[model samples]
Target: MLSGIRIVEICGIGPGPFCAMHLADLGADVIAVEREAAAGAPSSLLNRGKRSIVADLKTPEGRELVLKLIEDADALIEGMRPGVMERLGLGPAECAARNPRLVYGRMTGWGQTGPLAQAAGHDNNYIATSGALYYNGTPAEPPQSAITLIGDIGGGALYLAVGLLAGILKARETGQGTVVDASIVDGSAHMMQLILASRQKGLVTGPRGENMHERSHFFATYRCADGHFITLGSLEPQFYALLLEKLGLRDDPRFAGKQWDRARWGEMQAHFTELFASRTRDEWSALLEGTDVCFGPVLSPPEAAAHPHMAARDIYFERDGLLQTRPAPRFDGQAVTPRPLPQRGEHTGAILAALDAQAASVWG
Candidate 1:
């Protein structure tokens, strides 16, 4: 969908490269800039489908080369603290001045103008500020960080890609460029909209694990006889009834009424704990897979890769002896082929050759 678009990615950890990968997957011409010292480093899955070039922005010539690439590009994505780009002489203002139609995207943990914009932080810190961390984990335990997936990939990379595409559409229409400030904190907070609504409606409870979905037996994970886990999400009455029937739980009066009542939650959970322990995870999966019982076995990474549904969907791909997920949403009736992750600065010569040709054409 993004054919003919040219994007320059200033390489960083986590989200920036991920956003660039998405663009490249959609057929955009993406060039990733890596530091000379970092050349020949290990390949990263997030940097797939991109040509890489080595440039030390600290040098005047290197900085000039990046500016030239910006002039010929449609967009630039960078993940850096507020003033870091400005200090390096490649901030949004500098880039946009070179190409008025450029969509300059900045990805940061905090917003560009916030008090914590210049502070050092990571995904855990960002999600903590957004109340997302509060709602994660079991009701009895302190909130566990859900890895970098939520704040970095979900918030930063996905939101930045959306913002960049929106900006690109507007720039195409107006012939004017803009800056996209995509903050992980803001995006994470935005992701909690449903929880906020539940709270406002007085349907949610305090103290973390007491909520209907978080603490309730009907919507949580349970251990089976083999010590493997299974998840349940039978929120509706019909599905709940189906789950009860599947587990032979109809005789229990404790789960009979007021599914959302906190007073009976403990009793319901205990009843479920006993029921789930009678069977293994595989047995439970067999009983629940085709029904509306909202059940699934808890799968580890390797197990997930080999899951029947995942295999049918072609979700995982092996390239260059490395396993990674394929680009999402099959396009044009064709699956996006997985490309091997690039070694740092792998395509420097080819990318610079193309840039040199463009420069020579302009001079002529």
Candidate 2:
């Protein structure tokens, strides 16, 4: 869908590269500018489908080379500390000067302006500060989040991608540029709006696991006989009824008609815990895998890849001995086939040749 768009990504770790990879998957011509020293480093899945060029940004000529590239690019993205891009002379203002229609995207854990803006932090630190981590884990334990998934990928990269696309749209119509400051803290906090909105219904009250989502027996994870886990999300009335029927508890006084009796939830959950442990995960799956029970066994990445539905859809595949998932949000009922990962600086010669520029002119 982004066939004609061009994105210039200043090479950085984590969400910045992920965003560029996503755009490239959507048919954008993405050029990743790598530091000269990183020419022969280990391969990164984040570099998939992107062309690579190496340069030393510290030199005036190197910065000028990128600025010239930006002059013809639709968007430029960089993940650096608050003032690093400005110091390197590749900040939004400079890029916009060269191309007034550019969308300059900045990604960070904290924002470009904040108390901890210049401090070193990562995914966990950002989400923890955003209050999105408050309800995670049990009430008895400190919050623990999935590494990098919530903050970096969900909050940072996804938001940056949306912001860049939106800015590009506006720039094309208005003949003006935009600077998108996509901070993980801000995006993660914003992502909590759904749970926060539950507060209006008195569902998100109390502390931690005391809330509706974490406290209910029907909406939690259970460990089975084989030490594997399964999840249940029988939230609606009909689904809860079907779950009780499948477990042969439909006529039991404790659960027959008391799905919302908060007073009995602890007792119900304890009973469920002991009952689910009597069978292996697959055994339980056999009894209730596809119905209104809203059930699923917990699966690792490889197991998920081999699952019937996922395999039927061809969602995951192996490449270079590494597990990888296909590009998401398919268009016109088709999944995007990912291109091969480019070797570091593999396109340097051709890219420079296209510009009619020499390496020494930029490297010096």
Candidate 3:
């Protein structure tokens, strides 16, 4: 869908590379810029489909080269703190001045103008400020440090990509560009939109794990006899009834007429704990494979790859003896093929040649 779009990715860690990867996957012509020494290593799975070039932005000549590339680019993406780009003489103002149609995207943990914009932080710090950390983990324990997936990839990369695409489209129409300030903390807070609405309407409780979805026996994870876990998400009454029937607890008087009654929640949870522990996870999975009971066995990464449904969907693929996930949402009746990731600066000469060709034509 992004066939003719051109993206210049300033190499950094985490979310910036991920956002560029998504653009490349969607058929964008993405060129990644890395420091010279950072090249020559094996490419990472996330760097697939991108051509790489080495440019030391600290040097006047290298910074000038980057400016030249930006002049012809549809979009430029960077993951750096607020003033870092300005200090390096490659901030949005400089880039946008050279190319009025450039969509300049900045990705950071805090927003560009916030008090904490210049502070050092990571995914955990960002999610903590957004209230996302508060709802994580068990009811009795402190909020657990979550996997970086939510804050870094979900809130940071995905939102930055969306913002960049939107800005590019607008620039195409208006003949002017805009800057996208995509902050992980802001994005994480935005992700809690639905939960905030629920809280405002008095439907959600003040404390963690006291809410219906968080605390209810019908919508949580339970341990099985083998210490493996299963998750149940029977949110509706019909689904809840199906889960009870599948677990052979339909006729149990302790669970009768008190499904959502908060007063009886403790008793109901205890009953569910004991009942779920009676069977192994595999045994439970076999019994509830295709039912509307809304049941699934908790699977680790390797186990998820071998799952029958995942295999059928071709969710994971192996490339050059490396195991990696395929790009999401098949398109145009064509399965997205996995391209081998590129080593840093592998395409530097080719990219420079193309740029020189364009410059010669313009000069002529």
Candidate 4:
């Protein structure tokens, strides 16, 4: 979908490369600039589908090469501290001077103008401040954090990708560029809108794991006879009825009609825990996997890759001795075949030659 769009990515860790990977998956021509010393280093899966070039941005000549690429590119993505890019002479103003239509995507943990913008932080710190990590787990447990999912991937990478694309669209229409401040703190807070609304409506109450969906028996994971886990999400009335019937508890007074009764949740959870443990996960899956009871067996990564449903969709595959994910949000049933990850600075000579030719055409 982005076949002809050219992007210059100033390589960094985590969210920056992930954003560039998304653009590249959508068919953008992305050139990743790497440090000369690490030019031949092994790249990660996030750098797949990008062409690499070696350059020391600390040097004038190397910085000039990147500036020249920006002059002819539609966008640039960089993840750096607030003033880091400016110090390197590749900040928004400098790049915009060369290409007014370029979208400058700035990815950072705290955003460009906040009080914490200059402070160093990681995914956990960002999500904590944004309220994304304050309400998980049980009330007794400290709010747990996943491995960079909420703040880094969901907040930082995904938002940066959207900002870059939206900026690109506006630039194309008006011939004017935009500086996208795609920050983890900002994005994470924005994603909490639904939860905040729920709180205001009194749909959820208190701190930590007080919400019905988090603690209730009908909406949580349960252990089985084999020690494996399964999940249930029978929140609606009809689904709740199905769940009771499937578990042979339709006639039991405790579970027959009290799904929304908050006071009886502990009792309900105990009942579910005991009942679900009567059978193995596989046995429960056989009885309720595809029904309106909203049940599913919890599978690990390798097991999930081999599940019939995931296999049918070809969601995971083995390539180049690595288990890789297919490009997401397929275009009309067509997914981008993920290319092999490029070695750092693999295309330096070829890219420089192309740049030379373009320069000659303009000034010769």
Name the top lDDT candidate: 2
Give per-residue CA lDDT, model 2, range 1-364, as digits (tens). 8989999999999999999999998889999999886547755899899999889999997898899788779999999999999999898888888899999999999999978999999999999999888898865678899899999999999999999999999988998989999999999999999888888778788878787677788998899999999999999999999999999999999998898898888899999999999999999999999887999999999999998989989999998898999999998999778998999889988998877654456676
Error of 4 at 52 (Å): 0.9
Residue 113, model 4, lDDT = 94
C-alpha lDDT values of all predictions = 0.86, 0.91, 0.86, 0.89
Q: Show the colliding residue pairs in model 3.
A: none
TM-score of each: 0.95, 0.96, 0.96, 0.96
How does candidate 3 fare on TM-score? 0.96
Reference-based lDDT, residue 240, model 4: 93
TM-score of 4: 0.96
lDDT agreement of model 3 with the native: 0.86
Error of 3 at 299 (Å): 1.3
Tens digit of lDDT per residue, candidate 3, span 1-364? 7899999999898999999998898888898988778435777677899988889899998898889888889999998778888999999889988999999999999989878888999899899998878887778877876577879988899999999999999999998999999999988989988788988976576688788766788878899999999988887789888888887788988775668788788778888899889999999899987799898999987788898998888787777887778787678656687556888788888988988999999999
Candidate 2 accuracy as lDDT? 0.91
lDDT of 1 by residue, 1-364 (tens): 7889999999899989999999898888898998786435786788888887889999998888899898878899998778888999998888888999999999999989967878999999999998888878786778888698899989889999999999999999999999999999989989999888989987675767768877788998899999999999998899988878777766667666667777888878888889889999999888898689888899887788898988888788777777788887687767788555677887878877887898889899
lDDT for predicted candidate 1 compared with the true structure: 0.86
How many backbone clashes are present in model 3?
0
Once fitted onto the true fold, the runs of candidate 1 whose alpha carbons sit more than 4 angstroms away are: 332-334
What TM-score, to 2 decimals, does candidate 1 have? 0.95
Q: Which residue segments of model 2 deviate by more than 4 Å?
A: 38-40, 357-364
